[model samples]
Target: MSQAKKIMNDPENLVDETLDGLVAISNGLLAREPGSRVVRSTKIEQGKVGLLVGGGSGHEPMYGAFVGPGLANASVSGDIFAAPAPQHVQEAIEAADAGAGVLIVYGNYAGDVMNFDMGAETAEEDSDIESKTVLVRDDVATDDYEGRRGIGGAFYVVKAAGAACAKGMSLEEAAEVTERVQYNTRTIGVAVRAGILPDTGKRTFELGDDEMEIGLGMHGEVGVERSKMMTADEVAKKMVDMVADDLPYESGDRVAVYINNLGATTQMELLIVYRKVAELLAERGLKVERTDIGAHFTSQDMAGFSLTLLKLTDEIAELIDAPCESVPFTQG
Candidate 1:
């Protein structure tokens, strides 16, 4: 088989090199922990609850890019599609610790749960810094709610917790807000094609020209169903219907919509999807308080997108509107 073509000094150095580049270009906004894959903010507000997040390397601007003011104070990264080591997670926990406490936000993947949990235990045992966690499980395709995998809806969870911290909320308060965000969100994704694995230089999954997979995972995990391709509007209605009905979002309720690109899909295509989403919501008399469309989370080179909706209460809406500064996301 032909080796995969990647622009890099060495595949082994990809993660480290990427971290170095990110910090250098951050304009003093970020710093790297010595000899570790953890990256943290250079400025942490005193006496506020610190927010920490982490995951593998392939999903750029995700667990890492979202670290900054009004967001995560630090983030830990592992190898592509691999969970960070417990020690790496611990470093982030330590970096995010303010006098108040720290809150760890991450996906519901098994490895992430185990490592972050271990890191929290280690921090308490060593330094007595109180830490808590909120696991994001927004994918609606899975029947096992507790075991549902986290995906695009993670953005809402981070935003809620970060804002709570920014408001000087206690650790318990921040954690409660984050949990509320997690429960009030739902996401569903479809893939027209699979992504290529950098290590192997091959597609993670195979799809025919006329086929699409619904509820596909970020890491190429099996989806719930496969069928012939549908029009952009048809796909939009199908996904939005599933997500909306699951939450039983009422006609008078407002929501925040996030349309995320998986990897290789064009912005024009994503916009087309969003247009249909907007129209469908209007038809249902559901108000769109906010809408975000772009490639926030991705499966490396995967050709598809996911839709996330956050059912909004006054508190959640206010928190979502709060200011945030991060590498990939910033708002007033």
Candidate 2:
């Protein structure tokens, strides 16, 4: 039995209304570009790299929350599970330009690629500004299955890009760093249940109480494999192996670990998964420099989780740890 749904309004109108709320609450630290939902930095510092990132709604602290000092200069938000309109993306690029050029980074999804491509063309209208995009297609399951899917690995890219931009790296330099990070990253996910749409009150998909889907998508798209439920440790191992195999990490390889919640999974469950992942990494003689386990990104109330790993070099490690004071992400 599903619990009753309670939202401000219907699902179709959620994105628009939420953006309104976000702007109202950002305290002028953020502002949406004219006729665009991409939150732009009010204080654009000249000669510093400008960063723009975005995706679907419901993943709150993502595309929007990461806008501020040390993060993205702008974010173009989209409807739930849908890509932002191209015009919005262009506006974001325009708003964040600070004479140093802009780096557009985002998750790898079909709609996103299409719209952002269109946005890039629109950006070229201004020859004085240079722009490039880096796509994070780190999901090992989808990466192996043919269609590239964007999952939890996006947060790491955002964090790294944000730091580089804040450090006043040239647009080309920041883009190169972002691309390198993309090549070194991998992710995998599993879902215990599906999410419900506020408007329809329906589960996005069906799964048996005793079953789970491995490699589930954020929009409730069917996963690569449906299997009998396994123990938390077993599930964690399966997830870790899926990602590690894709990277084929050699012994002693340094990495950063991100354990992202899909919405409904509890912190306690996440901790359990992390414990298994840490032990497994040690068994494989790998070193994890940073382990981030939380709701860094999410689907709408979906009961699941994903693991992302980024092979790290010294330079990338410093960028990852760089301080960011975004509304949602703040580091001392």
Candidate 3:
């Protein structure tokens, strides 16, 4: 019943306006399609396979901020927490497609799957541009692998997909690698505070002043467990336990650890949690191959974070180590 506190002019035009500002900030590396919500990067790598990713907006620096030379070629944005239309998806695919075709990487939600599939069909029919799809399913808190939803772990999957394309892999090859990369990844998140929905000015959910919800979805779906707030170390141990156990990562394994801020949580808090996460991984005898920490994917101002682990193979390690540049994510 509480209205959300936020900054803005009109919720109706928030998504488009946000894209406009994004393109402006992109320094001409990105642009919006005429009369649509599709945004594509200007720095396309010719003769290389294209990587495209999209979904609902509101998770800033996600599907949109990821467009650039080394990440997604184009991004199709929908309203906050809403799926994009198939028409717009087709537009993005056409724009992103070069001589080598586009690989569409998105989350495993039902609306996204249906719309992205329809878009792929239209793109092939209209321009003969080939496209393939890879669904990211890394949220271990969900019912099962098949029923799981992609959460913060999507960042790593996008990184792998983009790196695959940058390495000149064929569309099919990139898709295959992306699928495997996703398969090796697992994630779990906890929320201490809910995000405020821009459209209705309503908070995503409610929590007690001193309580936490474990395993909540990116969109504020109820978590599997809720309890009184605990210390950062306690939260980290529980989250890492869920993620590490879901993949059932074995001792002596090398892994990439990503700490994603759900928004509103401070960097200081994140680092504190990371220290514990690193300790936990070490206790399990897993060698931390690489560490990424920041607010890559966020839900407005939700005060929480998620931990993701990618079990590394020789091939996946190479992809993860490969350098890439984008608005929100850039690394070597």
Model 3, range 1-332, lDDT digits (tens) per residue?
Answer: 55467789888889988999888888888888555788888889899999889999999988778988768888889889878899999998988887899999888899999999999998899989999999988999986798788888899899889999989999989999999999999999999999989898788999999999999988999899999999999999888888888879999999999999999999999999999999999999999989999888899899999999999999999988888877777776
Clashing pairs in 3: 4-201
What's model 1's lDDT at 101? Answer: 85
RMSD of every candidate to native, in Å, equals 1.3, 2.0, 1.3
Worst 10 residues of 2 by lDDT: 141-150
Cα lDDT over the full model 1: 0.89
The segments of candidate 1 whose C-alpha lies over 4 angstroms from its true place after superposition are 1-4
lDDT of 3: 0.90
Error of 3 at 23 (Å): 0.9
The lowest-lDDT stretch of 10 consecutive residues in candidate 3 is 1-10
Model 2, span 246-279: residue lDDT tens: 8788789999999998888999999988999999
Give, for candidate 1, the lowest lDDT window spanning 10 residues: 1-10
Candidate 1 lDDT over 1-332, as tens digits, reads 45556667777887898899888888899999556788998878989999998898888878877888899889999899888999888888898998888999888999988888998899889888899899989998897889999999988888888898989999999999889989999999999998887866788888998999999888989999899999999999999998999887889889999998999899999999999999999999899999988887888889999999999999999999999988788899
lDDT score of residue 160 within candidate 1: 86
